[model samples]
Target: MQLLALGINHHTAPVALRERVAFPLEKIKPALATLRSIWTSGSPEAAILSTCNRTELYCAVEGKASHETALEWLSDFHGVDVSHLAPHVYALPQSDAVRHAFRVASGLDSMVLGETQILGQLKDAVRTASEAGALGTYLHQLFQRTFAVAKEVRGQTEIGAHSVSMAAAAVRLAERLFEDIARQKVLFIGAGEMIELCATHFAARRPAELVVANRSAERGTRLAERFGGRAIALSELPNRLHEFDIVVSCTASTLPIIGLGAVERALRARRRRPVFMVDLAVPRDIEPEVSALEDIYLYTVDDLGAVVREGNAARQAAVTQAEAIIENRVDHFMQWLDARNVVPVIRSLHTQADEIRRTELDRASKMLARGDDPQVVLAALSQALTNKFMHGPTHALNHARGETRDQLLSLVPTLLRQPER
Candidate 1:
């Protein structure tokens, strides 16, 4: 089986398509189980990495399993038409697959050119695959090497320096909507890492009031207390939504938490005052229809891509350095994969040698059992083992004709070379 990476990312598809294919954290394990079932013949190894910007499947698949099969499987699982999804999908086989994994782990493939969040997301994906029993020797080795390469790139290059984080981009975009962030009351709708990050950036501006609303009130309170703010349950959003001028949401809910009607009510409550809203969730925390509302400035994860892509020009040198490091590691990983190919041949050779030794030892043991001269039996056994070991190469060398003979004449000695004292 060979390594294969096939999927769509922010570079290949729009948010509408990406969100359709995205597997949430809770669904990844089942998705992996289903993918492995599709390739029953290969005993396939599969891992899925799903984030706000991308959803990718990495697999080790054997013969007769092409990208078409995987694409069809994905389309069926997500209920998307193959015709529409195929154009945005990419399939990288063997070395290309290895290279892609390395680049993704090292942050070269992220929408935000040196973002570190993807590495953590990848680790979570790999861990999920492991729990699901989808990670075999090949995929396990691939991710381990991928993580190592990512660490090396981070250590050797300044790719993350001067980088524009999504949180910072959200803040910059919010600044354009409001004259002063300090005068605005901000509500963060999730207490996850992304929410924490957004809170940090927004807090730097010292907003008038900061609040956190989460499904788990305790977790929300803990996160809010960090910024000297109070927490509220998600149930309170409808009643309290209009109180905040800016809202940033990133929750794991599969459905839209903030609908058009809710936002409309909030706008009406504020007498049509403009509410700047950012939805950083994958499936989207806010309804897409809400963007059509006249008095609301709503942005999804895709909307922030342009903002985060800015200010990356100065990091180009570090990007190049990181790419170079990834390429070198990719080559090393491919070499290791190549070595794995010869393992069966090496095993067969050892098996043959062991069989020959057993046959010769049986004959020698019979000689000793019959009371034959001990030294003579020992000599015969030693000679027999040596002859058997050399027989194949000697016969091949003797029978080979012309150039083949010359090649074997040169190769046989190396194959049977003795260790130096």
Candidate 2:
């Protein structure tokens, strides 16, 4: 089987297309099962890494057409047209797959360059795959090394230094729209890690009122308590939406939680007062239509790209250093993958040798049962075993002509030699 990395990311596709192909957190395990079922040729192994910026499938599949097979599975599962997706999708095989995994884990592939959040997201994906029993030897080894390379990159280089996190960028954007964050009421929709990070950043600015709206009251309460804020049910958002001047949302909901109608109602209630909004979710918690409303400033994950990429130029040296580290690690991983590919050949060779030994022993046993001379039989058995073991190589060397014979002449002694102390 060959290793393949297939998906579309922010670099290759717009958020509209990306959100369509994204796998929700709860859907990942079942999606993995479905993907495994689609490839009937071999015992295919797969792990999916889905985040705000990308949704990637790392797979170990058999056959020459595995890449196309992966693309078809993705298209069918997500219900996206092949024509719309084929241009944006990248299917990386073998070493390219290894390299991509390493780069992604090391934060080189993030929208926010060198941001550490994608690494955590990747780990979560790997853990989920492990729980679903979707991981096998190939994927298991790939992620382990991917993590190690990330740790090494972060430890040895300044790739993450001077980076503007998504949270900080959101705050920066909010400041641009409003006179002061301290005077604005901030409403965060969701209690996931991204929400928590945004809350921490916004809380540092001391917003007048901080509220967390979530589907789960318990999780919202816990998150709210951490930031000295209050929690409310997501259902209550429409009634309370006008009270907040800033809204930031990141939720796992497949559909838009905040519709244009709700925002329009909120705007009417506020009497044309501007609301700066950030939607950090993949599928998006806030509606795309909300961005069109007058006096409303809305930004999606892609809209925040410019703010995140601000300090990247200054860190170009560090990026160069990180790239060097990833290259070395990718080479090492490919070497391991190459070694793994030959394992069956190694097993077959050992099996052949064992068969020869067993056959020679059985012949010697038969001779002893017939009352043959013990020393003669023993010598004959030894000779027979050696001849049988060497027959293939001896025949090949004798029959081979020109360059092939010359090659065998140089290789035979080393193949036959025992290790020296």
Best by TM-score: 2
CA lDDT scores, all candidates in order: 0.91, 0.91
Candidate 2 local lDDT, 275-358, one digit each (tens): 999999989888898899999999999999989888688778988998898889888888898898889889999999899888
Question: What is the Cα-based lDDT of residue 285 in candidate 1?
Answer: 86
List the candidates' TM-scores in order: 0.89, 0.94
The lowest-lDDT stretch of 10 consecutive residues in candidate 1 is 61-70
How far in Å is the alpha carbon of 421 misplaced in model 1? 4.7
1-421, model 1: which lDDT tens digit per residue? Answer: 6888999998999888988898978788889989988886857999999889889999997665588888999999999999999999999999899999889988888878888999999999999999999998999999999999999999999988888989999999999999999999999999999999999999999999999999998999999999989999899999999999999999988888898888889999999989999999888889899999998999888889899887878889998898888888888988898898789889999999999999999999999999999999999999999999988887887788999988888886788788999
Give the poorly placed runs of model 2, Cα more than 4 Å off. 62-65, 398-410
C-alpha lDDT (0 to 100) for residue 284 of candidate 1: 86
